[model samples]
Target: MERIILHCDLNSFYASVELLSHPDLRQTPVAVCGDPTSRHGIILAKNEPAKRFGVQTAETIWQAKKKCPDLVLLPPHHHLYREYSRKVNDIYGQYTDLVEPFGIDESWLDVTGTLHLFGGDARALADTLRRRMRQELGLTLSVGVSFNKVFAKLGSDYKKPDATTVISPENWREIVWPLPVGDLLYVGGAARKLLGQYGVDTIGQLAACKPDMLEQLMGKMGLQLHSYANGLDADPVRSRFEKEPVKSVGNGTTFPQNLTTRDQVRQGIAMLADSVASRLRHLGLYAGGLQVTVRDPQFRDRSRQTRLSAPTHLIREVTETAMDLTEQIWKPPSPIRALTVTAIHLMEAEDTYEQVDLFGGSAATRQRSEKLEAAMDRIRGKYGSSAIAYGAAAPEKEEDPLP
Candidate 1:
């Protein structure tokens, strides 16, 4: 039997959630944006009206305002969004156990087995889910019903606001082939450009191309795209309980002022590495490698990666390695707008074994450091994140303290 997959995508999620509180602005062009004063002045999400005004997400606040002079800007309420996402997924749980969340705003559900209980009609069930979301959560979503995850996601994007689009075996080729090749799953900018060079601009064109040719051009991703374009995707929707292991853990921040000295850069890297290490410990994972990215004033980014001598979740090791990686790509006295530290090549803590050198006594030092960090974690959990921090990782205090 063919799988019955549904991809549900919340429409203008952040903006819609914000409008729930400000019902008066529902008709106005509104956008949820990051704080401009903190240098995060970008459009995170925009409502339908804002879309009509040519405002787009990830564009600067000023650029959005320039397109729509009367665009209403609201600060993001991340906690509230998370709460709603949980509630929305709870509703999905009522329908099927095979619910795989793509992100906070999107999820894929496999209703192949349970469709009979919900009237055995995929399109009807999709419509019902959409209606329930709108009535219960005061939010709208678009659902795509198809035989595979990729096509179902594309189906959801075919329509907008609160609508259901079904692409079945009988009509999938007719419905999907006419769309842009980029509309297919995993066909990113680089792949799209490569396909364009070969005159494969439409889904039909991509499907018509030989898989071997695509593999020759794009390696493995080429073959994957070919399968997706031909509606041969067999990927299953995993249940929420089947958590996928994280590939990497990272954190980044844009500094209020450009960091121009070695001390300032070290401080920034330490702060970011502290967060990365803390998260690694929480997940009971350790990093086998680390990567650091530095962005200058021109928005140009330089990145470097290095393999650790041994897997570790220690803050000192992560910070030191990240600083070394940053120094390789960056020089002191050069202004740095932002910094990111990523813990890569992760392994479960239990699966990792520490290697000790005969002369260094490093194993004993690491054991002590682990205990201290664990104690710190307990203290912060009992009190608050601000209750305790590593001395070197803590943010610098202002010269004139605020009252």
Candidate 2:
């Protein structure tokens, strides 16, 4: 019996979500762009028309405009993307919680357990999802149904716009073999260059090559390359909801001019500790380690972490640890660009609360903080996120804050 993994990728996800918000942009050559002026700013996604003009994603907007002069560009809005992601996940969970998100825009569904209840046909279930996405969300999806993660991911990528393909064991060779060497799942830049040097420019050639030759050229990864080149992958379908995160942390930003100084970065770190504690209480997790990251003016990135003597969920203790770690990360008076704080080595908040000495000020302070956190979570749950936030992240309603 063969296993199954169904890969579903939203076509032009960010662009599609934008089209949802601004119906007028539909059918136009729109591109979801990041700051074109920033070194990291580039095209994130775009409509088909833009792609046809050779406007590749991650290409600078200046380069994009050279390809399609009239291209309309939009900025990335993670918050909006998260909203649609939740909506899509809700839709997918209706089918199976075996669903694992591939990225913000793509997900994998293991419907092996539910295939019988849905009429015993994987293709039909995929088609239903495509149509429903079109009907309900006005979005399109490229779906692949195959025996494993490798072929399923390939199936979605193999399709054209708004299409579905099923790769069965019987037809895997014919349907997959002739594809270009670069299209094989594990064949990256180095592998392609090496395979090209060996005159293996297609999947068929790579698959037909002696296993010894592949092992010699690419080492251990070559074994995986040769296997997936012939359509095979055994990666599991992991549930994002079922598995607790190894870390529970929060971060907040308040960069004036969208950039800031070293002191401001420290304050942001403090705010992040508060936000992280709020989340730790919400998730019932505690942090055993803390790290602070800084992006300097030259785009140089640096980070440092410190382990706590004991895990903690208290805001002050985490903040103090993070600040100490920050000193190790940066020598103040340097040109700082952005800062982020992360909590790591997580344990159940219950574990921390139970393991600590029950008679100390640390325990008393933690108990008080947990109560405060519970209150904040309730308010945010009832109203909305940011219903309660660090004073640094105060809101001024904006028409285009997200765009």
Candidate 3:
């Protein structure tokens, strides 16, 4: 039997959520942005009114303002956005157990087995869900209904706020083929440019390309794109119970200022490593390797990964390892715009045992570190994250602390 999938995307999620509180701005051009003074100034989302003026997401505030001079900029409240995301997903859970979240503002639901309970019409069900969301939560979403996940996502993108588009097997070839090949999933800038060079600019042309020739042009990705264009996607939308296992835990942030000193870099890495380690411990996982990525002011990134001598969930160990890895690819006096630390090669805490070294510290010392970190976690849990710190993560604003 053919599968039934629906992709739902909240329209201008951040800006729309902000408009809920500022109802007067509903018809005004508005955009959600970060503070430019902190070097985080960029458009995160824009409402329909702002979109009409050509405002776009991720562009610098100045760039957006140039197009929409009357644009009203609002600061983001991430906690509020997360609350809405949870509420939206809970509503999705009402219709199917196969609801799968794609991002904070998007989800894919497999209603194949339960559509009958909701009246057995994919387009009707999608429209109903859209109306409920708008009437109850004052938010709008575009929903795509199709026989598979990929087409459902494409369908969702086919329409606008509070709309539904259905792409069935009978109409997909006529409706989806004439669209640009770049409209297909995973066909980003590089792939789209390559396909254009080959005169495979449309989805129809891409679907008719020889698989072997495409493979030679784009390696494995070329074949994947061809399959998508031909409507051959077979990947399942994993339910909550069958969700993919967590492969890595990572944290990153754009700094208020470019980091140019060793102390500044250490501080950034330590802060990120702390979050990654804490998340690993909370998930009951240990990292057997550490990966660090450093982004320069020009937006270029340098990354390095190193295996750990023993799997560990300790903040001290994670921080030290990440700092060491950063040293390999980065040097002092280089302006760094952002930093990320990831705990990779994950294993369940209970399934693995620490590897003790003969030349390393004794078992008693290891146990002490674990207990101390655990105690710190408890303290922060009762108090707040700002209540504790160590080494480069210390909250002292006196001066740079690294040597």
Candidate 4:
């Protein structure tokens, strides 16, 4: 049976959410992004009016202002966004327990068997949900209904304000084929360039290409591309509440110029390690393994990893492992481009108790470290992560923190 999936996405979420409090900002151009002074500070969100002015996410705030001088730039209120997200999720759950969060502003819902309860028509259900949300939360949401997550996601895009769209097998080809190849999920830069060779420039062209040609050109990703192009997405609407994470923790940066110093590379590793460590703490877990991914000046990417005898949450330990692995992993002297640290083999924070029996590590020491990590997180949560920096991180802040 063709399943029914609903993808709900808020319009220019952070900006729209802010507009709720300041009703005057409605119909105005607004963007949200990083600090104007920081290189990493780039536009993160641009509302519909601002988009007309050519403002886009990841553009500098200065550049965004150039595009729309009156553009309102709001700093991220992640906590506030999260609170609103929960409310939205709660609303979705009222319809189906299979709802999955795509992020702060988007989610997917499975309405396979429950449809009849609400009369089973995708269009009507979408309208009812839209009205209810507006009445209760004073927010606008666009919904896309399709057989799978990918097409439903695409259905949600290219929508009018406060609208819902349904894409199904019958009109899938005629409607979706003429759209750009990039319109299909996962067709980014390299994929586009490669597909252009087979005269596959649009969803129609790509769909017509031989499956073997796609597989030969793009490997596993080609299959996904083909399935989505045909409006045949069998992938389940996975519950976002699942504990298993797709990836543990990792970081990356683009540098202006290459670095000639070994110390510079080490400093980058330390900073990235700190980032990974912070994430580890957030999950109430520790890494029993580490991986360091490096990018050279020429854009070549490589990675190395180490398995630890026991998991540790100390930022210094992860940093040291990352630096050590980087030495064994990459040849030095050529200018370095980017560094990333990832932690894996994560076990719950409470899992430390079993370690004393297995490895003969001191239970008291383990308890103390866990307490210390929690306290540090608490302090950092209120005062910022840099308010109390680790010794290794002290030298790092002097350089660009974003990099």
Q: Which candidate should be chosen as best, given lDDT against the real structure?
A: 1
Clashing pairs in 2: 284-349
Q: What would the per-residue lDDT of candidate 2 be over residues 152-248, giving only the tens digit for each residue?
A: 8889999868889999999989888888989877687767988999899988898888888889888877888888876667877877587634544
Candidate 3 error regions (>4 Å)? 171-244, 298-310, 324-329, 350-372, 378-384, 392-403
Model 3: how far residue 250 lies from native, Å: 1.5
Q: If ranked by TM-score, best first, what sequence of candidates would result? A: 1, 3, 4, 2
Tens digits of per-residue lDDT for model 1, 1-403: 8899999999999999999999999999999999989988889999999999999998889999999999999999999999999999999999999999998999999999999999999999988989898899999999999999999999999999899999999999999999999998788877788899999999999999999999999888888888898989998899988988799999999999988877788788888888999999999999999999998876688889988768988888888889888989887677899999999999996778767632254777888989999998999889987778887787665232112
Question: Which residues of candidate 2, in runs, are more than 4 Å off?
Answer: 20-27, 33-44, 52-68, 74-104, 116-121, 124-128, 135-137, 149-151, 158-160, 165-247, 252-254, 258-261, 297-307, 327-329, 350-403
TM-score on alpha carbons, each prediction: 0.83, 0.63, 0.79, 0.73
Candidate scoring better on TM-score of 2 and 4: 4
Query: Scored by Cα lDDT, where does model 1 land?
Result: 0.90
Question: How would you encode candidate 4's per-residue C-alpha lDDT over 1-403 as one tens digit per residue?
Answer: 7799999998788877777777887789888786644444678887788989999886667788887889987787778889989999998888888888887899999999788899979879888888987889888889988888888888888585689988887776777889889878888877898888778899988888788878988887898799788876787776667754535677776555565566667767777777788788887787878888787744477778877777876676787788888888666566676777888767775664344322354767667756876787889999997877655655543333232
Between candidates 3 and 4, the one scoring higher on TM-score is: 3
Best by TM-score: 1
Local distance difference test, candidate 4: 0.78
* TM-score for predicted model 3 compared with the true structure: 0.79
Q: Which of candidates 1 and 4 is the stronger one according to TM-score?
A: 1
Model 3 C-alpha RMSD to native: 4.5
How far does residue 266 in candidate 2 sit from its true spot (Å)?
1.2
